[model samples]
Target chain A: MATTTTPAATPGRTKGTGKPAGPPGRRPRRSLLPYLLLAPAVVLELAIHVIPMLVGAWMSLLELTQFHIRDWSGAPFVGLDNYRVVLDVNSAAGAELLRSFRVTVIYTVLSVGLSWVLGTTAAVLLQRPFRGRAVLRALFLTPYALPVYTAVITWTFLFQRDTGLVNHVLVDQLNLLDDRPFWLIGDNSFVALLIVSIWRTWPFAFLCIMAGLQNIPDELYEAAAMDGAGFWRRLRAVTLPMLRPVNLVLLLVLFLWTFNDFNTPYVLFGGSAPAEADLISLHIYRSSFQTWDFGTGSAMSVALLLFLLLVTAGYLLLTNRRRNDA
Target chain B: MRETATERWTRRIVLTLLAGFVLVPLYVMVSSAIKPLQDVQAAFTWWPRRPTLQAFVDMWSTVPLGRYLINSLLVASVAAIFSVAVAIFAAYAVSRYRFRGRQVFSVTVLSTQMFPGILFLLPLFLIYVNLGNATGIALYASRTGLIITYLTFSLPFSIWMLVGYFDSIPRGLDEAAQVDGAGPLRTLFQVVLPAAVPGVVAVTVYAFMTAWGEVLFASVLTNENSRTLAVGLQGYSTQFNVYWNQVMAASLVVSVPVVAGFLALQRYFVAGLTAGAVK
Candidate 1:
């Protein structure tokens, strides 16, 4: 991985043509061209992404109420009051935010863990040659290929109380339940959201793991098998070790995407999410847009962003340390 | 390795069951889209009893679905093309040239991906509102505003993907081009870029799909006239009378281009995704 990335990271470092030096005046101009070429993208990224982040942090500090939303410059400077409100566990709002944060954490852990495990299992199953593998691969990838709204809206229909397929299958066909279950409205909403989340995301994990599987040399597996290693033993000794780096990257990416995911819950639940399934993204969105509290919303988001940054840094450190130790 | 009969049968059965699990929701969606409203609500069937395009036809008249689709297409295509075009030049510079602050610039590009996009919503909304107020340019509820926002998210990933792609091309190609007296830009376009066509298409597909399915930004940034398909889909159920058939029909329509696009370019998409992860 390091070798593959170094070319882009420090290209032209080792390539000294050993040709006669260019004219003294021409070197500087030639060197500046790369910067010129990179300017538009750099500038746009800064203006569109970076500057707004700074502004968001600034907005979090102010008392930007709905009355002042139209012209925000005049909004009062609250100096962490918004953060205080969100963090004040004694307050009803703060207590709710804390509960939502806990909910978000649980959702992220479950969604990421299930997707990765299922994905890795599927990838291992299909790693070797098989008949009709091509068709099976395409079939497995269908969920990931479809747009999120399409998939989740279909889930919304399937989770309908009376007419949905899930209930029909469980109640009418399988006789598992006597009455229709309200999937979208209660504690079951969390279960419903998890099913949709895992359904949409597992294929992605499968794809990444499959790609990672390609890099494992076949010789190691052959040697292990010769040493009297069976399927589980060979997998544990050879495959998992080789897949560590890929899994690290995959896990972090999956966690981040799932944690920041806004579309799935929004589409499945519509405008306001049920309390049981209130992931932080929708919670913050409602606080800001639905209730017209941009300051509190920004503050909550800033907190979330800071939390993610800390988590990512810690994850990278732990993974890198483990890799080095191994 | 050779497999026994039971092992082969087991693999087949497990894979087939997984495939069925994957396809069931999609089967439900397509079937619901064509089924009559009564049939959809009253009882579930494997296939539509009276299959019709009436729902698809009615979706348009019901809520300006055509306009939403056209708006989504226009925004997605423009953003994809423009973002990829800009990213190619930046990618080339990073991949080929050694410049001051190169490491910092590259890391900055990667770091942008880590920030949650919702963090930008409030500030960007404020910026657009203020800019429109000052200049009388209507960005508050316009496609242009949405396009610009989408570009930010799309550009970073596109640049990163293209950099990996450009790096894979042998340096000898550029060196040979230079020997023949081709300028750096000319060599980039004439020699290196032609080889990176797969990467370009991969980036284009990625950017297009990102913009196509975007709901959070589109929901906030667009209104009636400027609404994209994503937000328009929301309107179908939010109104007093819920139209399940039309909603499903509209979603199917909105998803077709992206699904087809991903299937056609599945190879590139997988390559692009793995390139970033493994490297």
Candidate 2:
């Protein structure tokens, strides 16, 4: 793993030929040149991003309710009926589709906010040099690195009704509960997903925050400390404002990523009786694959895309405004 | 910088407790994997009564654990190799270039990261289905298709992160090379990249881990044939009776190597993480 990376990065570290491209025409060249430079990434995004979305948009308009497409000509062009079926509470699909959207919103907000605070706290505390910090830092990232399925499975096992470790400790050792607490399988799907999701996502927040914290020069704090200000004051006065941009970006990313995440809720609840727990992602999975309703599934996906596109546009606008203000 | 006694104490206590909190789930995974089935059935123990490798043995016998491990390793390694190579060039282009639409491109790239993978699923699945039908050369329901999908997720962040590292590299080095008659290409390769070794290592460990641990598309796109470790473990739920010990053992197999990877790539991983190597 270590070796594979070095060769790509070690391209031109040797002695150089000295005929420089002068600064004269550099300004004009740079204007068009950077666009050329970013051409590959734009092209890749077009392939991965624009094309699939266009395909989905087009597909959503077609009436292909079943899995296998047969009689395409006979299939009516039912424009937005699929969407109305999805949104109308009277319809079979609307109830679950709307439920999923509500749950997704709540889950995304809570998960992202909690993860950010925890991440920010950890990053702040671990910012300065300390003994055993290196090892602790690695441990901090463990949950994020533990793939979703593995973490979910482990969490489910720990939360099991009778023979789970959490129950043993909470009930047997400390007598925290009279009976085994229903952690994963209970009335509150919201609580269960929140616990596991927060635990798993904090590492991402940690990475973003710690990275930002490191870049904050020690001298800023030194100057503050010399003035006899406490840690909280310094953090509030200095750290928070400086980290605003990175935090915004991180928060935006987390909300979208966690919102789209399909597997976490699926692994925990398995589209079971408590339909309130179903997220939009899981709804898409079940609609398209399990129930074999591709048209409605494709419509839900288009809705998701619009919501995301709007969020991205808002975030970009805010960040760009901040950049301009700065 | 200054710490009060209360501050010091709270920090120490929270650190210790949080560390313990983090270790509990992992400890449960390890202990349950080693516990005997009868012991497991009776109750959860902080330490099992008679720890045995019975669960591991059973897990190996029952599921195709070895196949899943090999399949996951192959896909992750290949993706890491190809994606990092591509990420370096792509990151280079984004970071160094000062052209028109640069901001739009950067925003677009970041925006793609925000694009929900869920929305793309049905469309990508349909495309894969068509691929399988039209050409016998379909990458669908296989490692190849999965790798391509994983790369789409991996590439945006990798490029963004590489751009971050590129920004930190002093333009002086590149300019010095240019002054000494090197082209922009040579300058980027010779000067900019080697200085960013830590960043590259960071990207590798990150991309590898992302592929290694994700279950969303892995479970959806491929069925039983090319199942990865995460999907392999999910199979334990199929039987009406939950195989607690075996399932725990299977999870252990997945977590151990990744935890080991985290341990092995410590400084580079942590540094790169801060430097935007992983996200």
- Cα lDDT tens digits, model 1, A36-146, are 789989898888888988999999998888898887889999998999999999998799889988888999999999999888878888989777887777777778878
C-alpha lDDT score of every prediction, in listed order: 0.84, 0.75
Residues forming the 10-long window of minimal summed lDDT in candidate 1 chain B: B175-184
Candidate 2 Cα outliers beyond 4 Å, as residue runs: A1-44, A67-75, A270-273, A315-326, B175-188, B263-279
Candidate 2 matches the true fold with a TM-score of 0.88
Is model 2 an incorrect, acceptable, medium or high docking prediction?
medium
What C-alpha RMSD does candidate 1 show over the true interface residues after superposing them? 6.9
C-alpha RMSD (angstroms) for model 1: 5.0
Cα lDDT of model 2 by residue, A1-326, tens digit: 11212232333343333433444213224344445445655666776677777877877887866734543335567898889888898787888787778888988999999889888888887876789988888888888878778888888887777887777888999998897777655456678788788888888898778777766787888988989879888989889977876787788778888888777787776444256567788778777877766777888888888887788778779888988898
Candidate 1 clashing pairs, residues 3+ apart or interchain: none
